[model samples]
Target chain A: MARRGDELMEFSGSISTLEELHALSLMVHEVASDWGISEKVLFEVSLIVEEFCSNSVKYGGIPVGVGIKLADSVITIMITDSGKPFDPTEVAVPDVTLPLEERKAGGLGIHFVNHFADTIVYSRENGRNILKIEKKI
Target chain B: MLINTSQKENLQIVSIEGRLDSLTAPELELWIRDNLASPEFDVVMDFSNLDYISSAGLRVMLNLSKAAARYSRKFSVCQAQDHIREVFEISGFDSFIPLCDSLDDVLAL
Candidate 1:
């Protein structure tokens, strides 16, 4: 963990496998717990990390870098991957109101991320796909 | 994650323990396909011991629910922790998958 400024505490690393995603989940949980964040926020953060990191490893076909920063009442998650230039924000949100038979499982992860995160932004920079998400605690 | 399966009357009670994310979702999918391949599709997934789940797990459950519907079989989930339940609700899974308060409730259904 590194202190970026007077109020920001940051943790960043690269993960290459699904097992590393689990480790990342544990690390984020421990850090959030140590910071005394609420369990609800912790759950959201855990799911967010899992969804993003797994998507990167499964689809990006390259090592993914994750950065988590906690400052005051907000937590920011940033994911960068060198695999492809895909922007999740451009995808359409699934129709969650559809009945079971008509529902499709694809895109729900990104939908959940969009719902849970207070704000999200995506961009391609220097051949890396970057996604930044923020949530208020 | 660990899956413990047992026969309960007409239902196959599956108790899942630990996290269900992208890494373990495939295992659950394979287990469902292999173990629950029978024509009798009445199944109850007991989530009392499950600590966490991600969208991957939700997708698996959705597929299971759809499979049961296609076969005209019963499927339900019971005893989900509050956080887990919230995940289901957030994703609108509770709308289609019958959520039971207890194993007996699912068995009775």
Candidate 2:
């Protein structure tokens, strides 16, 4: 198990793999629990991992890398993929105010990631779009 | 999660047990849309036996809540274990939807 505040742990895999996604999410859960994170905070971390990994699975072109760090009572996870640059923070929030028939069919993933994350930063660097999410313990 | 619903008067009480994760969330969405999204009925999910929920499940619930608002019907949850309830709290769902201690409380609303 990785300790909190470890500089970084990196995982590289194909975005199309379900097994890889599951492995990554489980790793997140384990690290979060080890950090003495509250269940509420744990769920938030898990949700962010699920949403971002799903996006990578659905959209990443060829390769994906997940970088993790824990420090200052906060966990920072970044997912970088070799796909079109996607800034999740710029995606519009779903209009929960809209009627069901009027609402759009997708965008729930981005919405969940945004709602659960305390801070999110997105950028395209070195031909990779990196989405970094932070959740406080 | 596997869901079973029983109706009383104008309310449809859906009971969920087991896990509600990504692959199954769509099934739940379809069930709610098919059965309770109609304008004529209100909705409350009885989560007393529900053991798990993922982000996908939360999305379905949020969509249902929005649909209920459109029809002037109420959407709420009845009963949730601490972990499941914690999921709701982190997502801010507890603020958006009414939560009761039991099915009777939901029915009395």
Candidate 3:
């Protein structure tokens, strides 16, 4: 695992590979458990991490990394990828009220991220995509 | 994830006992397609043991519900944990998929 900052704990698996999603899930579970995160908050944290990481892995065009940090009852998830400059925060929230026939498959992940995260910030700098998500525990 | 399959009153009862994410969703989808393709029987997923599910898992549920419509067979879910139910509600899955209290209850729907 690569430690990117003083506070952020980086996960071992590269965040841009589908093979790493399971490792990420398990790692998140263990880390959240250690942090005493409640089941509901843990689910939200996992959803944010898994959804963003998998999206990057699928379409990020290159390897990505994830880092997690907690402070003041708030957990922060940071995902950095050097792939394309996709900004998930800007993805349109899907209409969940649509009937089954009109429901789209892909946008739900982004919608969940939007719903679960208290705040989402996305920025591109020096050829890397940085996304920060915060959820209060 | 462990998926236990059983039969109850013409419904294929699938009880999942683990997290369903991007990695496990495809495998579950494949299993559902392979074994539950028969239109003669309805389907009900038992989620009492399932504690975690992501959008990927929700996507599979949506696909199964859509498949149920295509095949004209009833497909529903039962006994979801609170977090699981929250996911369903937020994603609008609970509205379209018949959520039951138990396997025996699925027969009533």
Each prediction's whole-model lDDT (CA): 0.86, 0.72, 0.82
Give the higher-DockQ candidate: 2 or 3: 3
**If the candidates were sorted by their lDDT against the true structure, best first, what order would they fall in?**
1, 3, 2
What are the per-residue Cα lDDT tens digits for candidate 3 across A39-114?
Answer: 7887888888888888888888557777787767777788888888999877887888988888877688888888
For the second chain of model 2, what is the TM-score against the true structure's chain B?
0.91
What global local distance difference test value does model 2 have? 0.72
Candidate 2 lDDT over residue span A49-79, tens digit each: 6677777767775456776667666678888
Clashing pairs in 1: none
lDDT of residue A30 for candidate 2: 68
For model 1, how does the per-residue alpha-carbon lDDT over A1-137 read when each residue is reduced to its tens digit?
43444534777888999999888888888877877688778888888878888988988957899988887678999999998788888877778888998998888888888878999889899999999999988
The chain A TM-scores for the candidates, taken one by one, are 0.90, 0.80, 0.86
Q: Against the true structure, what is model 2's DockQ?
A: 0.23
Q: Fnat of the models, one by one?
A: 0.70, 0.12, 0.74
Candidate 1 residue-wise lDDT, B1-43, digit = tens: 9999888788888999988989888999999899776538498
Please tell me which predicted candidate would have the highest lDDT against the true structure.
Answer: 1
- Provide the lDDT at A3 for model 1: 48
For candidate 1 chain B, the 10 contiguous residues with the lowest summed lDDT are B35-44
Q: Could you tell me the lDDT of residue B20 within candidate 2?
A: 68
Q: lDDT by residue for model 2 over B1-109, one digit each (tens)?
A: 5789888888888899865666567789888777776647788888887756776788788788888888889899988877777666655577667788976777787
